[model samples]
Target chain A: MTKPASSHQTLNDAGEFAESIPHEKLVRSRTAQAMLWVLLIAAVLFAPALLYPVFVMQLLCFALFACAFNLLIGFTGLLSFGHAAFFGGAAYICGHAVKVWGLPPLLGILLGGVFAAALGYVVGSLAIRRQGIYFAMITLALAQIVYFLALQLPFTGGENGLQGIPRGTLFGLDLNNPLPMYYFVAAIFLAGFLIIYRTIHSPFGQVLQAIRENEPRARSLGYNVDRFKLIAFVLSASLAGVAGSTKAIVFQFASLTDAHWQMSGEVILMTLIGGMGTIFGPVVGSVVIITLQHYLADIGSWVQVVIGAIFIVSVLLFRRGVVGELARMLKISSV
Target chain B: MLKLLLAQGMLGLNNGVFYAMMSLGLAVIFGLLNVVNFAHGALYMLGAFVALILYSYVGLWFGMSGFHIGFWPALILTPIIVGGFGILIERFLLRWLYKFDPIYSLLLTFGVTLVLQGLFVNIFSASGTPYPGMPDALKGVVNLGFMMFPKFRLFAIVFSLIVCLIVWYVIERTKVGALLRAGTENPELVKAFGVNVPLMVTLTFGFGTGLAGLAGVLAAPIYSVSPLMGADLIIIIFAVVVIGGMGSIMGAVVSGIALGLIEGVTKVFYAPAANTVIFFLMVVVLLVRPSGLFGREG
Candidate 1:
């Protein structure tokens, strides 16, 4: 019963997060971790040359979104099926701000994040009243409201969606070109990832992890559990918004597709398949899924079935997911 | 305005009937197994499809185009078939997930929902087919004192209300219901008493899903049976489940119908907000009583 590691990796995966319980041998050493990050950056920098920039950017956007989602489900122990409202809602906001309001690209995206944060606050406050499945349901229903507003709102262009959003100038750099746009996205994605990493390591993140592991224990310790959850929810939602806004700028259009429940499910799938709380899991998940979507685009709804099947497989047999399994097999801290 | 109110209220009540049936199933499943049946809507959709295929396409592909099952037979058969499917789901997929977080079961069912919805979309296209025909017994409109309504619609509303009542009575009154409640409270204790708790759980899930199927059969003629129909309805049902709190049977029924009527009446006065009124009501309910209207605080 006594293993070198305190807890089993698969069990940790079952708990809906990653990393360790108490002390564990799974944490990759700092030097190796830093080297891994550097290598990842190098690969990413050259990724456009090797593959399509558009495709790479798409992966990055979703990767960021998944990571944003992970902050709640993995770290905070809150599962939200309503993240699409923020993702798609902000896509529209950022799209409108840049295209119609004539704001700078950076500002528009920032506005989108702010909008998501506000939306997140309202949704999170209401959702935090309930826990577990009820929490997920509340967020979902609230997101549906937002979706309805998006559909009926005058500026969203209804079914056609807000379209042809310009990739406006950022400090005189033309984002109309893919290269400038790539770096801009890469920077935001990097910032988003680092923010997540820092939050996880921070004391506040420790409380969140504690809350995830045991809410009552955390509450008994006199930490305002709901407040912590609300903050985490808002944070997750805003980052998701930032990702959505970034995606809108890259794609130069915002549509109802982003706000749909399917988009929310997609983010959940990415995080789950990537290994939830693992640092690089969502990135890996986004890559595999987006690549699959790209290649299998012609098949239409069959792709959804395939994705659903993958989800079922991942939950049943591969609960540790691709990256989670890899990390467990290697016994290196999950990437 | 009163006439419009009466008509919309009737429409709302019809919508609420589906919500009540669907949420009732969800509540029953959730209360016992602790798993939210995300596939409830899809199962509802499947029920309608079962009725559709049996009524029209039962041997159409096999050179027996004229040999179609009738509505009455489908109404009887669809629930049994869909419930059997639910039993299979519980035995194979859901059984393995009980030890993990309840959320995983939700995710698994969600995956099932997506698979079902996707497959249906691929095969049937997104556009829905009608239920083909209603038997002469349920066709035509009935003139209420103030307004006229479809005979089938009224039958559906009343039938579902009866079904909801029976389920409520069964769970609240009967010995089998006691076994279920006992299992929910402590499966081990019930097992110690020599009852099969796992089997009970499976049956509970099956019965719950059977209700969903029954609702689908009831709904087929009222609305076009489509692949995506359940997807949207399921969200509102979630709101219903939240507001009613899955722990209370009456809460599910009352809130489901009430919210539907409210949404319908809203359409009469403020058409734009009708779709989202239930959601807003959910937020208010969560704020006022986080445990739901009839739910005990966790």
Candidate 2:
């Protein structure tokens, strides 16, 4: 069980195998990265012309939310079923600050993120006490508490929700305009994506992966496992908050739906469908799901049935997810 | 006020019966499958819907005037039907998920839940449907001097208690119960003793989900049989499971009733807080004893 040398050797072997693939062949190869950048730039430039800005903005928000969720589940091996607490909780806070307190959009969003981080600290402290399945249930139960609080709180507007929030100016630019708001959301998403990328490649991320792979071994190696998990939890929650805040501004409203358990389940679906533990998986997953929802809106509740079927199929047969499968087929390992 | 309290306590105990039944299923399923059965709520809803269909449609098909199968038959039949469904789910869907991380099973069950709920919502609109109350024999309230208790509710409470006790007895005292305990502790060892562990696992899941179905049938008359009924009650039951500690049969039973009573009392004193009191208790429990009231520390 304490075969540290063999485990380390296996890790090195996998690393070598990854490295053996030529740079151009790798999924995140320089040319591939350049192509992705070009595609992203093109999408940002052309998507608004083809799609509604609000729709695009919503997709981006969910994409970022899924990515933040992936940070914990994929990298740190913590499957939280209560992420809507951060996502929806932040949305409410940001909406309240912007609409009532007259804060600028950026400040409001930041305030929401900060609040989510604090919430993460408190929730993570307690939840991290349990491992695996219990952890998921604990987060879920706590998130339900948050949901109830949202329903009861006057500021949340109860069932009606916090509606008609003004999309305040960002850096003196009126974000009420679609193009500016779209670009603003796009920029925030890019920054978030990059930050997640950086974090996963960082030393802290290395420790997290180690813990995910073997918690007991990681602990035996003298790492503070709980602290690492808590930090990852906070980071994931804060990023999720950022996505939620941006969503509140883009929509100019925050509703109880944002903080719902179903929303948490939706994020999980997005991540799982895209690729768990892969950098681009959640983005791809969110895009596919949001796009499906956009087109299938006419079907009403049938969409849920389809989504459920997808979840079952994905878990049973396509566990690697779309991007994860793509990476495997391409013979490239992606973080 | 005292009478009101007594009435609320009875209501609470009634709700507790459902909670105990649901959580018992959850604990049993979790103990063997190691999956949280996120679809437990949906299964509960399915149970009620099954009863409703059996009452309405089965009678209609049989061409009998008002031959709706009432509470008594539903109590027996709903569990069998739902438990059979559970067996199918375990055999086909959940079986494949065992090798993967427990989260995948959760996700799979969640997907199943969504599908179940969606189908029910599509069939019978989201609004609550009324199931007829107890038959003529069980109609009327009992005057207990302190307060009046509905005969149907009293029957439900007593029936659920007996069911809970029988499950406890079977799982704790009987020979099969010993095998189940052994299987839960070490399936491999149990298998070495020639016990068909996998079959036990499937049956355990069926039994657990059967309990959920029974609760649904029992709850149909008391609460409006809505598509969202199980979804609504499930989160609270999850809290109960957490408070009692998952996989603890006795813990689920005791805490389910205890929490229900607590919630009932809270409803009388402060109506607003009633919905959230159990969650608050859960948080406090976590802070004080992370493993829960009856759970052994890992």
Candidate 3:
């Protein structure tokens, strides 16, 4: 991918200049990375037995969703408030494909990701033209259009949503059973997590971070900033779609709730509470939030009040979030 | 077809008034504070609820049978109360955020919105509470050859236009408006010239929120007062702001009305697309002019 030596001398100098700085790495050492992997594997293997399989599956879906969201907001410095459109839109598409067209489960989920990537391309192209707040507003407005479509489209089943999506067998393994379904979801989550981790460590990801830190400088270095951003947006959106499709398969339904703006807000809350820019923050955040929602279900509207309170507190007092705080306390430069 | 068009156009204009007012508030606040007020919708709902409570519960507590504060008093009082609350919010919550990224303020206001809406929902329930009808002065309809229009809706359109024009003239023509404009561009420079920039920022927030409150009171008679009313309308107004480019007062007003009319026309052509037509317009506008129709590129 390197250009000719003469043509890219200035860009190479810029890249070298960036690398010269003592950058704070996300994981301090290989030992930390290995420990984290071991812990994650242990949690995945043991958590389902300790908790309900369905709950673990639900948590995995949201964890993947939050990680995808973090890839944009945390790593790329693009805060898309319309991520639910990708997540929920894919859910409906996958649900319909499997339930009606009788596609294989894996293929249905892949189709969902492909559709979301296409949507991300369309939305990111339009949105990346605007800077900061306008980009957020534009994405939100576009997502609202998606919401309206979901509400009006015949295939989505309107307000009631597409119900009774069958969890078709994957390679003769009965996904209808909770144990198999849970393992399937766990595997998907791990794959999605690895993809995000790999992307963040890749050369493309370094370019994205450079663009985020200093767009004009990155532009002057001959990097096509918009192209990088679009690619990141597509990757983030498709991963979120995978999460959504998995959730639909696990639950056997796709509802308007998934597409709602509130769902968008909830994802933001998750990222914030878990810690923005941290690798494991979204996973931890999703677990905390989903668990809170489960326990607070009986409190009605008060749940919203509590969540709002948490948001305010986090923004005002604990901006680092739970994982961010832990990383700080441990004197780690990054999580 | 002409008659139907006229009727729909009138309805569109009525909706346009609310759109213009709310978007004007947003633009003003954004220009001055550099923060998008997500709680704007919740504050609008609060305005209607305040008016409702003053008319119903407060009157009842006073042991005056049917002694309501009425529309005239509400038009003046509701904004003052809501604006005052906004000032407090600015003083305690938002002042510290000016140094941070704009996104933090957006999240802060969103949190405030959720809290306010949630509390209101808990207290008042999700369903709407209807406001009493307009005064006897605006109780009837007027008829033209082509179409008949509701007197209340006509009054709303005219009144909102008057308010919008007054705001525009104040901000665009007056000396204080000059200072406000200067402060928005360079607060430090204005402060160097002995302007209380912080106070100006706070008052600007209050005034913008007050305008929202006024719109809410005005909306109460047409749509039932509910916690959810602002949430639904605010998204549409955001689209209006996007189309207008949030930098110019006239842009917000003109785009608000134009988008409302376009949405109305869409309703006539295809009912399902009406809810989404404005967003489609926004996409088209972004493609053609990324900085919006009147906005300056940052």
- Top DockQ hit: 1
- Over B124-214, each residue of candidate 1 has an lDDT whose tens digit, in order, gives 8999899985788999999998899999999999999999999999999999888888887888999999998888999999999999999
Q: Assess every candidate by TM-score.
A: 0.96, 0.95, 0.95
Of 1 and 2, the candidate ranking higher by lDDT: 1
lDDT of 3 by residue, B1-298 (tens): 7777777877888888889999999999999888888888888899899888877778789898678888888989999999999999899998887776677888888899889989999999989999883678887888866777778888889999999999999999998889889987888999999999998999999999999999988888888999898886878988899889988999999998888888887778888998999999999998888888878653
How many pairs in model 2 have backbone atoms within 3 A of each other, for residues 3 or more apart or on separate chains, i.e. clashes? Answer: 0
Question: How accurately is candidate 1 docked according to DockQ?
Answer: 0.57
Question: Which digits, one per residue and each the tens of the lDDT, describe model 1 over residues A1-335?
Answer: 01111122234435565434434453454555687689778877889999999899998999999999999987887889999999999999999999998999999999999999999999999998887788888888999998998899999999999989999888899998989999999999999999999999999999998787767667899999888998998899999999999999999999899999889899999989988877778888888899999999999779999999998888898776787888778666763
Candidate 2 lDDT (Cα, 0 to 1): 0.88
Which of the two candidates, 1 or 3, achieves a greater TM-score against the reference? 1
Which segments of model 2 are wrong by more than 4 Å?
A1-30
Candidate 3 TM-score restricted to chain A: 0.92
C-alpha DockQ of every model: 0.57, 0.53, 0.50
Q: Which runs of model 1 end up more than 4 angstroms from their true locations? A: A1-28
CA-based DockQ, model 3? 0.50
Instruction: Supply candidate 3's per-residue lDDT for A169.
Output: 97
Q: Better model by lDDT, 2 or 3?
A: 2
